[model samples]
Target: MKLADKHTPTKEVKYGKALGGFVVAVNISMLLCLVTENLFSYGAAFVSLVGTLALFFDVMITLQFILLVLEIWSRFSRLNAALQDALYPHCTELFVGASPSYRCSLLQLQKTYVALGRAADHLMSHFGLPMAFDIAFCICGATCSSYEVLVKLLSDSDVPGLSIGMPVSISEVWLALHWLRILLLSLSCAAVEDTAAATGVILIRASVVPQRRTAEFDEFLRFTLHGPRTSFSAAGFVKIDRRLIVSALTVVVTYLIILGQLTFK
Candidate 1:
């Protein structure tokens, strides 16, 4: 699709406005939940109490994941384009020996790619596992809460020997499977990034020093340059914007911590 058709200015404005509104709503909901849970904990109805808590935690986690993915994807795509532009013949370094900026830019791009790959790795290792656990926990919590409601209703029917300590439900298993799907998606991303990082580093080192160091540089370059795969053909590391990565991950971790306080305690 054409760029204009894909991302019109008006569409961007609409999305930005919607995002701001969503953030406001999220903050308001969190504050309200905190206040209600504390001040009128006893007065709140069971359904409202359980549903609101579930929703609050789920939304926070979902938002954090979405924001992180968007941030990484957008920045990575930009860096990819920048590298493509830099590699063009017209974008020559005027003073190859003295051009620190040229080398720095290339290195910076490579570093960003590495950062993206690292972030992807973290997502696969740490966040992915936690997300799976969280999904299971939330599902189990919901099932137990539902059983509590059901048991309470049944107790009022004058049943004599229908006593169960807690209901065992299979919702957690369902959620665990869902979490597995998400993990698989992230795992695919991680594998791609791992390959990119490994190959990029080798290529970047070879590109930097062809004759002075590394006997295999020539052979490596020849293979990489002529490789059928587009990704392996590239010379530099993936360029990621550190500021964006840090900011996104910070937001994610912060929200997760806040969510923990709001939920577990």
Candidate 2:
């Protein structure tokens, strides 16, 4: 099947765009707050303002890339759904005859799956580095921000400027946002992995059906099983799945603990 034949659902595209836009807007607001607070301080911190602006632009670019990644995953999922529908149509007897047309449909679905996997691989090749950077930045940002807040609380320092409250400071908010973004990214990648794996399972189940059991069906099944497995990884280092979020959180906590120790000393 041609690449143009597959189409992403309009609703999914719209939702992804809207969510990305909202995240970017919130991040911009946070960065603007930081900049404004710094500007109005005792001494004009032009250096800090430059850093804040750099962060602002960096976040904007990262969010835009994330939006693209999400759209690609969304389209992959939609293609997988279409493949599933092809394998199992509304009528139970759709594949009962095991005709040549049914076999062709299966082949087409397999081709589509391969195309989707290639698209995923292409995306990983191009965006994997940036995504790894995003994850590292989030982990470091969350850890450092949390550490600063903890140090402030422990020292009983004057809560001046943006660091006003004890429970909900600007740093805490920044940490929360970083963590949220990490969680969302992990979940989205895991979802794509799960969907692709499910496609294989569905094919296997379809091939085992008594009515659908045929040489052609078995051939298609073997072809699918032998093909490259679909998964999302970060710069070929680690696979992104549900466990990723937990592992990332563990790293963040460990770094925070180390930072705490160093600060206390």
Candidate 3:
């Protein structure tokens, strides 16, 4: 599909707008609370306000990453649908001399698959740098957030004081949200990768139908089998999949443990 045709941008746009609005409102409300508390006690809420602002940006980036995943998922779904239609054409006839309509449908499917691939590539290129930044941000955020939660639970004194004007529970909730975002991002990447791989399998299956084994079929099979496959990576270091979640958790836990040791010392 052409760029214009690819981006319907109705539902996704609305979702992004809604998320941005909500984040802004939350940040503003927290800032107001912090200001009120600071007025009562000079310099008491400064650290908490700064931490809240950092969290606001972190959450905003996470939400934007989620939106990118949604867009990628939608594109992959469209590609899969086109592949399915190509595999099983509407015409009931299965003989070598299929109807002209079937031929046209197959041609259209080929064009669609190519267009979809280009669109996916464009999206990846556009989001590549941002994704790298997000990965780094998430790793650091996860480490700090996890360590803070651990300290809160173990220490008698609340030295960090992350929740100055807000309830103490909010700090725990924020950490949970950070972890949840990481998990969802990993799952979304895996889903998109699987969907693209499924198209390749479907093409291979379609190519093997004994009733439809022709030179053209062989050529299309060869083309598809040799084409570029879809995959996702994080900052060029690790692939994004279910395994990534486990790996990220491991890193977070290791950091938390190291921090705990230092704190005790």
Candidate 4:
């Protein structure tokens, strides 16, 4: 297809806009709250501005990454749709292996699938450094935010000056947003593999239900058997799957425990 004929999805664009607007509004609101609390002191104003800028940039990068993930997922979804459409007519038991055209079509689709898998891995590789930093940012931020929340709730101190510049409500939102972003990142990355698995299912269904044993399908099965290796990962060090979210939250919890012990002791 021509580049012009392929258009960006309108719904995704609207979603991107909504996310960007929300991030901007939240950052601005947080900064305003900080500035108000500090009585607009010059030093606090400078610090809030710097912090807001850094936060805004960080969230924007994450948002862009999410949008990219959604786009890739859409492509994989379209691949599934294409598979169904292309093979529906030829997917009968006795006729599937007899058609030369079916084999050709399957070969083409296998190429598309392989290309998408490699592209997803390459995209992950490209973002590896940023992902490591982003996860680290989330880990530290979540730890502090959770600590603030716990201090507000569990501590016996009634002093207003105990907060580390952030209100408990803001800390709650901060903690939720950080995890939500990371969770979305992990789920979206993992969806690529899930969608790829759906393709495998389509092929396997053909073989299982109709018994279409062909050379092309065997080749395709061979590739799918190795699909997990091509899944998105963090510079080949760690996978960007549901487990990553679990691991990240585990780290946050461990630190939260340590901080609680030290503070409460």
Best-matching candidate per TM-score = 4
**lDDT, candidates in the order shown:** 0.43, 0.68, 0.61, 0.69
Q: Give a tens-digit lDDT track for model 4, residues 1-265.
A: 1111132112243354565466457645654564454444345667767766677677777777766776667666666776676667665555435478767767777777777777777677678878778877877888988999988875447744344555566777777767877787788788767987888888767666454567887788777776554467666666789998889889999998999778756
**Candidate 2 on 1-265: residue-level lDDT in tens?**
2361444223353366676677667766766765665555526477866777777776776666566556656666665666566667623885457668766766666666677778778878887887788888888888877787877676576633323343436676677768767876777677667777777677677765677766666765776678787777779777776788898889988988887666656
The runs of at least 3 residues in candidate 4 whose Cα sits more than 4 Å from the true structure, single-residue gaps closed, are: 1-43, 92-100, 155-165, 209-211
* TM-scores, all models, native as reference: 0.38, 0.77, 0.70, 0.78
Best of the candidates, lDDT: 4
Query: Candidate 4 has what TM-score?
Result: 0.78
Candidate 1 lDDT by residue in tens digits, 1-265? 1221222111232243465455447545544544354434344577666766765675566456545544444445555455444444322443343244445555555455546655655544445554545444543443444444444455566755445443222223333333333332343334344444445444554355323222333344454445433121001222222232343335445655564354434
Global fold similarity of model 3 (TM-score): 0.70
Greater-TM-score candidate between 1 and 4: 4
* Regions of candidate 2 where Cα sits further than 4 Å from its true position: 1-49, 157-168, 214-216
> Against the true structure, what is every candidate's RMSD?
14.2, 4.4, 5.9, 4.7
Q: Candidate order by lDDT, highest to lowest? A: 4, 2, 3, 1
